[model samples]
Each structure stands twice: as structure tokens, then as C-alpha cells.
Target: MLEISISSSLKDAVNDFKIGVIHYQNIVVDTLPPLIGDRLPLYYETIQLSLQEHPVSEVPGVAEWRSIFKKVGTDPSRYRPSQEALLRKIKKDGVPHFVHSAVDLINFFSVQHGIPMGIYDLDHLSEPIQITIGSDQDSYPGLNGRVMHLSGKIVSVDRTGAFGSPIVDSKRTCVTEQTTNALQIVYIRPSMELEEAKQLIQKMAEMFTQVHGGNHEWKLMN
Candidate 1:
């Protein structure tokens, strides 16, 4: 089993830096078919409905991520949560779509719930996912193949070095076609509750196993 732990520095900073980790086995994380297409109608409709509810800025989860970014000494405006960024684009443009199955599921959940989610290929990660504050000089290749700096940010690193944070996920461990085992993480701020994360994971896990043929287990690890 892989271990995931939080740092004292981060806990001292936010006092509520809680994270949920999930291990998925027998997953098919490839350039998936349009398996998630059936979800598009509902997904787009929900985003449209949400536009009537409130702006992304008024979202509690987005607000929490913004605060977390600030607490970690990063500029919240520059490194916005992936979900928040997607929401803004969708609100201005329209619902976006991805072809990868894992990406499809994760992004769908993010937009549906307005939370940030990251899924890494388990084979690419080192044991003991450590959550710690990043330094000014820390950098890694992003999923898009560009180098991303992790200066003054809260990040999670394995044996391969920093891979993910509230702002962005690294390219080294991004899920791919051959990623059968997945380490999925749903980022929740203190403003968010452990139970909330648990419920979301439970729902996603069910879909993953029943709809996508993956066996999974999950936990709420600080």
C-alpha cells in the first residue's frame, strides 16, 4: 500500500489542509473512447444551471482554494485551482470536453462539484506521497510537457519529486493510455469537509468500477 502524509508546516499554515486519496486497480486510463459522452448533456446542462446559481468567485470551495494558495505564499490569481479555471472558461465559453477516460471522469467531477481533482499513474509515482511546502527553485515538467515552477506553493512529491499541487499537476505522472493503476486525489480545503470528499470519492469509485471496469479502494488521509 502507498502512504500519504501531510507536513506540519502546511498544517500550521492552513490548519485544515485535508486530502482524500484513492487507489484504483485494473483501470483503463487511455485515449479512451467517447464512453463519457452520455454524460455531456447532463454536464452541460448543470453548468448552465449553475451559472444561474452564482459566479465561481462565490463558490465556497473555490474560495477555500484561493485562500490555500495565499497561505502557501503563492499568488492565488496566477495559480488558480484547475477546476476554477475550467469553470471560468466554461462560464464564458461553454462546456469543454476531454477524450481520455480518466481525464473525462476527473474533469467531469471537478466541474460538476466545483472541486480540483488529480489522477496520477501509480506506476510512475514513488511510495509515500508526501505533502509539503515547495521552495522558490522547485520545478517539474507539467502534463502539457512545459516546465512548471512550484515556488512558494504547497506540493505533493513522491520518489520522482514534486508532481502535483492545488495549482497544477506534473507531466511525469500524468495518467495515460497504459495507466492501469491510478492514484486519484480530490483536493479539499479546510472550508471543505472530510465527509464531503468521502461522498464524492464513493460516487466516483462506483462509476469507475461499474462503468469503467476498475477495482478501487479509498481513504481520507491528511
Candidate 2:
């Protein structure tokens, strides 16, 4: 089973922070089905309308995340959280281009719930994972080809090193077509209760299995 723990270093910064993890096995990671792909345009439109009336800055979850980022020393405006970035992109582009089944699913939920999410291929990770605040010396190659300097950021570290975060995930553990087993992490905001977060993770995992053909389980960690 996949296991994760919050570091004492991170607890000092934000003790109430919680992470929801879903582990999936025997999954097919490919293009999303037309049924799901067809709905994204509608989801994007809803987000676009929502953003026009309520700016991303004023979003409850987004606002809380910005505050958390400041507490950790990173400029939220400079390195916006992943969910905020996605909302901005959808507002500007009118719709999001698909990545793959797993990624596309997570992106959809992130936008729907205003939560930051990260997914990694299980085969690439080391056991006994930890969530901690990044130091100045920690950096990883990002999915976008930029090297992410993780100082003061919330990051996931395995035995290997820092591989994932709320802002952006490292290329090292990114899920792709070859990924048969995967780990999805949801960064729950303070506005959500632990029970709500647990339900959300359960729903997400069920959806993944429903759409991607997988066996899955989820856990809540603090």
C-alpha cells in the first residue's frame, strides 16, 4: 500500500494542512472517452462565467491558498497555485486542451473543486513518502521544461528527492501512456473539512475507476 506522512517541518508552517491520496492499479492511461471529453467545454464555460462574476483572487479556496503560500514565503502571484492557473487558462482560452485520461480527469476535478492536485506514476516513486516545505536548495525539472526552484513551497519527497508539489509536478514522476499504476494527491484547502475532503477523494477515485478501468483506494493524511 502507498503511504504518506506530513513532516514536522511542514507541520510547523501549516499544521492543519491535509493531503488526500488515491492509489490506482491496472489502469489504462490514454485519451479520454468522447463522453467525458464532450463535457469539458461545458465545464470550461461554467468556469469562465464564474470567473467573470467572481475573480480568481476572490475564490475562497484560491484566496486561502494565496495566504498559505505567503506564510511559506513564496509569492502566490509570482507562482500561482495549479488550480488558479488552470482557471485562468480556461477563462482565457475558452476551453482546455486534453493531456491524457488521468491528467485530464484530475484537471477537470481541480477546476470543479478549486483544489490543487498532483499525480505520479507509482512505478517511479520510492516508498515511505513525505510532504514537507521545500528548502532553497531543492529543485526539480518541471513538466513544462522549466526547472522549478522549490524554496518555501509545499513539496512531496520520496527516497529519491522532491518530485511533486501543489504549484507544479516534476517530470520524473509524471503519468503517461505507460503508467499502469498511479498515485493521485489532492491538496485540500483549509475551507474544506476532513470528512468533505475524504468524500471528495473517494468520489475522485471512483470516477477514475469508472472511466479509466482501474482498481483504486484512497486515504487521508495530515
- Model 1, 20-57: lDDT tens digits are 78889987665434556766756676786777679787
Each prediction's Cα lDDT score?
Answer: 0.78, 0.88
* Per-residue alpha-carbon lDDT of candidate 2 for residues 64-143, written as tens digits (9 for 90 to 100): 88988887787999999998888888888877667899999999998888889988999999988998899887899998
How close to the true structure is residue 17 of candidate 1, measured as C-alpha lDDT?
76
What would the TM-score be for candidate 1 when compared with the true structure?
0.89
Minimum summed lDDT over a 10-residue window in model 1 is located at 28-37
Q: Report the Cα lDDT for residue 69, model 2.
A: 88
Reference-based TM-score of each model: 0.89, 0.96
Q: Candidate 2's error at 90, in angstroms?
A: 0.8
